[model samples]
Target: MNEILTKERLIEARERISNQVKRTPILTSSSINKILNANIFFKCENFQKVGAFKFRGASNAVLSLNEKEMINGVATHSSGNHAAALALAAKMKNIPAYIVMPKTAPEIKKKAVAGYGAKIIFCEPTLKAREETLNNVIQETNAIFIHPYDNYDVIAGQSTAAQEIFAELNDLDFIIAPVGGGGLLSGTALSTKYFSPKTKIIGAEPKEADDAFKSFNDKKIYPSINPKTICDGLLTQLSEKTFKIITNTVDEILTAKEETIIEAMKLIWERMKIIIEPSSAVTLAIMIENQEKFLNKKIAIILSGGNVDLKNLPFK
Candidate 1:
């Protein structure tokens, strides 16, 4: 297989976005560790700018553009996090950003994207509609299309989160990340391979939105159709580029039930006193569901984002 990214590329991406992206904290809950019989470290990307790790990739994509590419600005279609991240990244560069969002996206995310000064175009809640809408926006504005997860630079940028983890900790047996379009998971897999070869990279997802899990097992790309998961951030299917990287580097893909995801999310909120969206909780859900596999192991979980609608939480 052709190499889509290199260790140098990830290092470069970290340096490129270092000034813009936050080095989010690594948090651990002793009580939770005792309960699970594992040493779990949470790479709290929920505390990241735009409240998601998407900011790293978005910043890298926007900053990688040259003068000509920046002329028309950047454009993308996202259910939530990526839209807000790209909007803020473009705004920082004093350029315009056009975002195509599903009408069903959380109101908080819609407001966040608009607050970042991006022009939002609402479309049907389907990948086809999102792609068609984004294409039209790009044609009309001549903007560069920065895909949410398919681009190499975006994947490289996402790898920095795992790189950060390796910097602070060593000999971690496994690293888990929630897989949506596979951007963060692919990046984490690459980082694990380069920085700590002994570490295994696992991708976690909601069973309701298990396209990535299915694709990984089948070795084929599958569309995410009518997925009914509360992890809104993980509703999208993986792109060819991300799928290729994931199939090659990722060690395993695991799925969590919807109720288990909610339980894990609530557990983190109560134990760590930190807010995490359902998407982030999928990692913990998998650990909770497969306790034997991770027993006494050192693990790192990437809390993908905290961009949930407060009034519409899954909990009572």
Candidate 2:
């Protein structure tokens, strides 16, 4: 387990990126608590830099680079959040960033990355196309590829969000987070294990994009194939590093239907008065579905992002 990501490493990462990243607040809603019959605390990473928790890992990865590694700058392929995050983090360090984004990526995200001054390459909406385009960019620019969720540094950085949760709230019964590439989930698991070992780590995914759910139960990595869900951020499959970490540390993986996801997102918007993307609501949706498991329990949910395009609201 130490080989994957040590507690000491997580602490160091927190300190490393503390100055760069936002220490987002923990928020709660009485309406949500009464509706779910559980004490829920949300780590609002939506307020984080780049409007998502991805900035935490991106900042850490970019800042961890040595002078030699920083020479060629960094690159990554993301549908939105990570691309914008890496671009902004690189821009902060005055380094070039090359981003490969899917053509179908949200227009707001495309503009955000470009606004950060990163060179954006558009590709088909397939993981293969994104990776192929990224490879060509790396070959041409020799940029250091900072994988969205696969790298240990990125994972360590993501752990800090859970670390923050544990710092303010003690003895949580469970820490739930949305699972996409498993970067955030794996990192949350590690933080739970190290900071509050008794607290279980739960990963929530959309049923339409249940690769992480299937992979966790099967104890094998599964590619995300044609996932169709409103949670755009939860479409990526788990990598070997994140899969191993999640399987070892995560207590369970739960899934929510598309309708439930939308319902959850709408509930937060109306009740909490905060905007959250569909992916961020998966954790809450699972909680609503599995109310029995979490009834009267103290839970911490990571609101992973708030990068939704306002014009494309899912609510009626």
lDDT string for model 1 (28-122, tens) is 99999998999999999999999999999999999999999999999999867888999999999999999998899877778889999999999
TM-score for all predictions? 0.97, 0.97
Error of 1 at 280 (Å): 0.2
Clashes of each: 0, 0
Candidate 2 lDDT over 1-316, as tens digits, reads 5575889999999999999899999999999999999999999999999999999999999999998999899999986788889999999999999999888877777888999999999999876798899999999999999999999999999999999999899989999999999999989999999999999989999999999999999888898989999998988899989998999989999999999999999999999999888999999999989999999999999999998878779888
Give the Cα error of residue 189 in candidate 1, in Å: 0.3
What is candidate 1's TM-score against the reference? Answer: 0.97
CA displacement after TM-score superposition, residue 169 of candidate 1 (Å): 0.7
